[model samples]
Target: MSTPTGFMQYQRELPADRDPIERIKDWNEFHKHLSDEQLRTQGARCMDCGTPYCHTGMELAGSASGCPVNNLIPEWNNLIYRGLWREALDRLHKTNNFPEFTGRVCPAPCEGSCTVGLIGDPVTIKTIEHAIIERGFEEGWVVAQPPKVRTGKKVAVVGSGPAGLAAAAQLNKAGHKVTVYERADRLGGLLTYGIPTMKLEKNVVDRRVNLMREEGIEFVTNTEIGKDISRDELLKEFDAVIMCGGATKAREVEIEGRELNGIHLAMDYLNGTIKSYLDSNLEDGNYISAKDKDVIVIGGGDTGTDCVATALRHGCKSVTQFGTVGKAPLERDIINNPWPQFPNVYTLDYAQEEAKALYGEDPRAFSVLTKKFVGDANGNLKELHTVQIERTVDPETGRRIYKDIPGTEKVWPADLVFIAVGFEGPEKTLIDSFGLEQDRRTNVKAAYGKYKTNVDKVFAAGDMRRGQSLVVWAINEGREAAREVDKYLMGSSMLP
Candidate 1:
């Protein structure tokens, strides 16, 4: 249970980040690491609550309240506090297939729901998680344990993102001949190209992919399903197919000047930069440069934050982010978003912090809506027409609606505009070709946990199944789908 009184003795602490000005000069990860001793103290801060809501994995107020992967949080915290590093890694791997990925990019919902957070602060769960997995890698504890007996059954996993990777790893562990097909040239889907190197380094992803390869899982890249290879060929070649193709259908802003030259989707911009950076350190000029331009990013979310950071790194002259809703409260409101639920509080993300440091002001403009893009004679976007909005809750339905404030119209100069509004669902070509049913959101129709599609021997999980979601949720869905696939193939299975 960790040290019983440890929570009282030590306060929560996190690894100090590098100065934003210096860190933004390059596209490398900015956060520094905590030493082993400090990490142990942070782990010791776990309160060992009777409920242990940190690992509950339940829905509260329409959002996940705890670790979506149902990570054995308390067990690992106790292990780390007890100085059993390897044991903590084992416990971490029991539920989550890729702690390194989650440790780096995940928002750490578990910390938000921590019992310690009820009053003072939450244990540094995410940092401790990062330390544990990195320690395992450093000590040569993490290795390939190929299955001894092959089931002789073959499985094909579509996509190479978190969900697809998780399913492939679990299925391979169950002795099924597994082949992961990624549409992208790289094995790690969004992890490889969609996210910037500063947030999640490509080598970190490659390290795990290489380990998976060593464990006998075959990976085929630049292979698009239903295009390069027909869906029928996949069904015919494999005993089972798990579709983890993420929700790549981006939600676009359909405005008058959307066709302007400087406007681009968030994924395209991010992926292009990474691709160019990787190929020749940006000498290829394949990416849309934000240099010396007034950048305006629409949609204030993680993707938007990433865009802001990327633009800053490209030496953008200025940057601004538009938030459709009003700014969140400075602190969690007990009357509304109570404890144990994911807090709806205003927090400065890395990108926002960097922007504030660079520009001497927060880049975000809340309660604002972009009406249309104004373009120059050359059809290049020049300005964004926007208006302030006030949120009003309907008395009958209790639904929140936005009302435009008259005479509050304004325009912002913008040389480059990025749409980071979010995703709708998976692309239609693959799902349509398979003749699979989809939910109203256009996500593949697969019941949670069951993961079975209407078509026999086919399953769906992750963003493809549940629209846009967190990486941790994708890992959970993928692991659960793998178990269901194993059961379908072998009648009964040992996968957890």
Candidate 2:
């Protein structure tokens, strides 16, 4: 530890955010950066605990305990404390291929499991991570490093999301020719389209993609494996196929008046908005606008929060987010969810903060389930009918079950409804075309650490294999899967 007593000397601090009212007026990132000295001091706060569960990356209590990538958190923290910015960046990239993305979007499960968090605030790990990478970029230290020797092997990675990009980066480093195929017009699958500009700007994604291209990884957009390109042709052309196609099949909410106008799936709405923003800055009317409309967002996860923020930015009259589960405790109840596990505590994300600033109150309505959508004669959604639910533990399974409360039906006027429930699993088109086996949840049946599918020379990773998960986990899957793919192709792997 660079500073033995540093943990006692400093408290956790993050960079200030742009004012919510002003930031919501535009679609740019709201975070401001801390000075080098301030960031160094924050880094010094890492306690370097004996056990150091912050980077264990284990699954505890049915959730993530720490960083799945098992980042060298203590090493980088010490490096930053000693003002070794470049060294810290090198250490960061050793674990994560795209620290910028994870730093910007990851919920920081590492912080949740921090030993210091059991007593007080955790170290600002995410902010320190962002500083290290951004500094590397500013100093021109981050650049393309193409492999020196060619292995004469080729790999086709389907999907250009975080998982695919990470796999391509790793496989290319192993001297294999890697080509990423994306069905969308852009290279980044979820990073560029599914996420809004304010959360993760498209230019950040572009910067990484351009660097990957320089590193000799090829990207082919507007290419669908099963639809545009034949599976047989793909299998014949590439020596190995890695299915990183994300779990994109959205979980649908089936109810009466579901086909009504002014109602859409969350991904469709977000994708269209980002595309329109990229094309002509949303002036061309290529997206569904929430302007002057009462918006109702179904689901209360990050996706639902994004929808709330996007609708607010579109000048919606009002917005409300519904969650099927009850609100989490404001503070962690140690008796229920013990320390060293990811805390099930309430958090005010950027979107919720923006909503509070704009609407005079938080927009979330917890423990609510939509019963049906009521529409006008013209098929335009007009109201949402919902009922409150009470949660109970099932004695046999010990799983929480929701029971609708009687006589609690309520209706709210709504002009636009976005279903941000979640995703089920990967799309079946490519999986079926490749004749791959599927798990009970419809994810590609590939064992963890092995990553091999039923078909020889075919591999699966990320959300396709693990079901919907965090970006950090996706990157971990990609890196691990790449190692397996490398071993399968070259008789052994040098990848960690």
Candidate 3:
């Protein structure tokens, strides 16, 4: 593998980030890259276990525990440790099409399963990944390569999110004519609008979108498949169709006064804010402005953290996040989460740090459940009532039990309330139109290896098929689904 002696001697190192107080003033990425030497040293910390579970990509405890894309983690780590930047990048891109995206946002399950992490800190797998991709981009190694010959077959991708983009890119590389349709005016569905610019810069996404366009992939915007164009029209116009529509429907809290004007869905607020920022610097009201408002977000997930950060940028008076789950232990809790699995220990993300810097304390309230929203006479939300909940595991049933404790009710003043619980599934219109079955989780029903639906010549992938998930998972699904579609279209195919 890599230099064996170097690995046992060096220590792991992670990239440093900007100060939270300064970072919240503007919408920019807070992460700072490690130097080339630092990155190589970090890679040298990989022990390169004989049984590398980091890239296994297998189901553990009924859920994926390692890299879902089955990235060649050990191979890349070795390459990086040897200072072979190009080779490491080549191996990384073999499975993942967009390492830049995942490097910044992916939770990095590969590190969680790293054998080196069983006893100490995991090898800096995420750091080496970022360095390799960033180097590729800087050295002009990444360029659009259109297929040499045309297959004369056409495919239509129904969304412009990560999954749709991945499938379209792969299908086009296989010499098939591909077109991506997006309901939004811009491409990069959630990446362009749903996510804030601070986490992932729009220019980064736009650069890739431009490259795809150069590769002769057609992108149609403001086109709703069912509403603007009929489903039959798509079936007739294309040889095959791939549905990558993301799960847009947000999970909402149905409580008293939820209909208040100031109350909004997390996606709505986030999407609006990003879109507005894109249009003439927010002058057109393209995004929801949280300026000068007392925002009380009702959820402690990534979405809620994003809301808190966005409100701080808008100069909000105050912000708080209500979470139903108990706070995680400060240190690794191997008894429950276990080693070689994702650690559920408490960590400070960018938004949480910014909130702490501004308010002098983190705004998270663990085990607090929102009971109801209180609205003013103008139909605007003014406050939120919440109660502390005790969570217990049932011994016999093996299920989680929650009980509201007495005398723990509290109220917080809130002008803007965002429900950031999560997402349910993709929209029902297209699934119903295709007569496709849905899983118990409301995702499009199809066997893991079999992407075919009830109808002929129809396939699904990403959030539409697997429900709300990480972007890396969407990329994996898209690649697998493209292989299935290519096989269906040409009997035998040559796509990797």
Looking at model 3, the pairs that clash are 272-287, 273-287, 276-286, 276-287
- Please give the TM-score that candidate 3 achieves against the real structure: 0.96
Tens-place lDDT per residue, model 3, 185-223, is 999988887778988998888888888999999999999
Show the colliding residue pairs in model 2.
none
Clashing pairs in 1: none
Q: How does candidate 3 score on lDDT?
A: 0.85
lDDT of each: 0.93, 0.93, 0.85
Q: Model 1, residue 35: displacement in angstroms? A: 1.2
- Tens-digit lDDT string for candidate 1 (344-444): 98889999999999999999999999999998898988899999999999898999898899999999999999999999999998998899999998999
- Candidate 3 at 405: error in angstroms? 0.7
Which ten-residue region of model 3 has the weakest summed lDDT? 57-66
Candidate 2 ranges with C-alpha deviation above 4 Å: 394-399
Instruction: Summing lDDT over every window of 10 consecutive residues in candidate 1, give the lowest-scoring window.
Output: 39-48
- Tell how far residue 238 is off in model 3, in angstroms: 1.2
Least accurate stretch of 10 residues (summed lDDT) in model 2? Answer: 1-10
